[model samples]
Target: MKQKWRNFMTVLVLKINKNRLHDEEFVRPVTDLLEDFKVVDYREVKNLDFDKVIICGTALKDNEYLDNLDKFSWLKNCKKPVLGICAGMHIIGKILGYDLIENKKIGVEDNKYYLHSFKIEGLDESLEVENFKGMLFHPEVLNKELIKDFVNLT
Candidate 1:
């Protein structure tokens, strides 16, 4: 018997700053979760063509992190699924009419310490995982107003 090949592919958008890729502790977990998935740098691709593209880390302007959001505007119009993690979430929020601002905290905390929770809004049963908990370590966060536009999936 032969194993079947899965066509699903995933691209990870990593920010390059000072000619180096941003390092985040969650990277390993995220990559492990998507075993066998293809990972591509967002800067190398001329177009947003993929089954799914995950945006991660901060891409500040002129910092070699690809801060030019206009270059990837096609994302808003594409049907392809997107998963923004941490800073990636902030980028998505900023693109979708929400402001991303700085918070006061820094450093990582265990999931038990933070107890972060999110509420699902404007979504039907089709989008499951309504309410759940997850670990987050960012000084900035998505504006409350934009919460309605996104479904919280842990």
Candidate 2:
């Protein structure tokens, strides 16, 4: 009998947090689901060889990453697909011209995956920003299937 091999995709996890402890809360869960991945600070997005990029979220109140927007400048020219979660979505939104005001809601809202919206609530557990590219919610906690889909798609 022949064994079937699965295609594994390399993922780059960008950690956006002030405290390393947040890595356990945010980064670890995402990395746990990936077969091939590398975790890097949001301020150090350098490598361009990964198949996909996952900008992991920080704590709800952890907004230190907001102070250094220049670190994510590479995202503008990055050809590889990317996914942003929670605070990750905030980084992307700021990069895309969305103001980072107290009003976290910057884009349109939809059912289920909020799509472009920055926040999620009620039945909506995540946001699908233009394809499965970005999400405003944490799949590691809410929807594990979505993360699996992202791994497969990338």
Candidate 3:
């Protein structure tokens, strides 16, 4: 019984914090998003060894990791599948030269990190796309101008 991600495993899970960033909180519920991969602290990005990457949204701020500044280059230069969620999305936004702005928290019943819905754009209509609409629970907002080149999977 071979695992789904065993064939050329390239998934890299970034351990992140729930508040004020930093890593060390890469939990199962979050890593479950990917079939297989290795979990590494956000600080050890220089040792990253994978063709694909997944960034989870955790409670984080800039000050926690602003000084470390080692993985940013690798993240920006890697030409592989990169999936950034919540805080991860903010990292991507910054890598892509966008400014993160505060938005009215569009949250669920009691979750400050879950938005009610998201309108996806910048997708190729030819591909079989699914789940392009749903709740987005994050406090950051990257202007449309910066995301024009990004693919929105909802």
Among these predictions, the greatest TM-score belongs to 2
* Candidate 3 global CA lDDT score: 0.45
lDDT tens digits, residues 1-154, model 2?
3222232877888998789887898888788777788888877766678888889887666777788988998887777777888777777766666664443443234433222234423213334444335566566665766777776855
Pairs clashing in candidate 1?
Answer: none
lDDT of 3 by residue, 71-120 (tens): 56577666666656555655555565555555433444342345322212
lDDT by residue (49-154, candidate 1, tens digit) is 5455555443333223335666456656656556554445444554565444444333344321111122112321112121211113321232221221222221
- Enumerate residue pairs that collide in model 3: 18-59, 19-59, 20-61, 21-60, 21-61, 113-137, 114-137, 115-136, 115-137
Q: How many backbone clashes does candidate 3 have?
A: 9
So what's the TM-score on candidate 3?
0.56
Scored against the true structure, residue 153 in model 3 reaches a CA lDDT of 28
**C-alpha TM-score for every candidate:** 0.52, 0.76, 0.56
> Of 1 and 3, which scores higher on lDDT?
3
Relative to the true structure, candidate 1 has a C-alpha RMSD (angstroms) of: 9.7
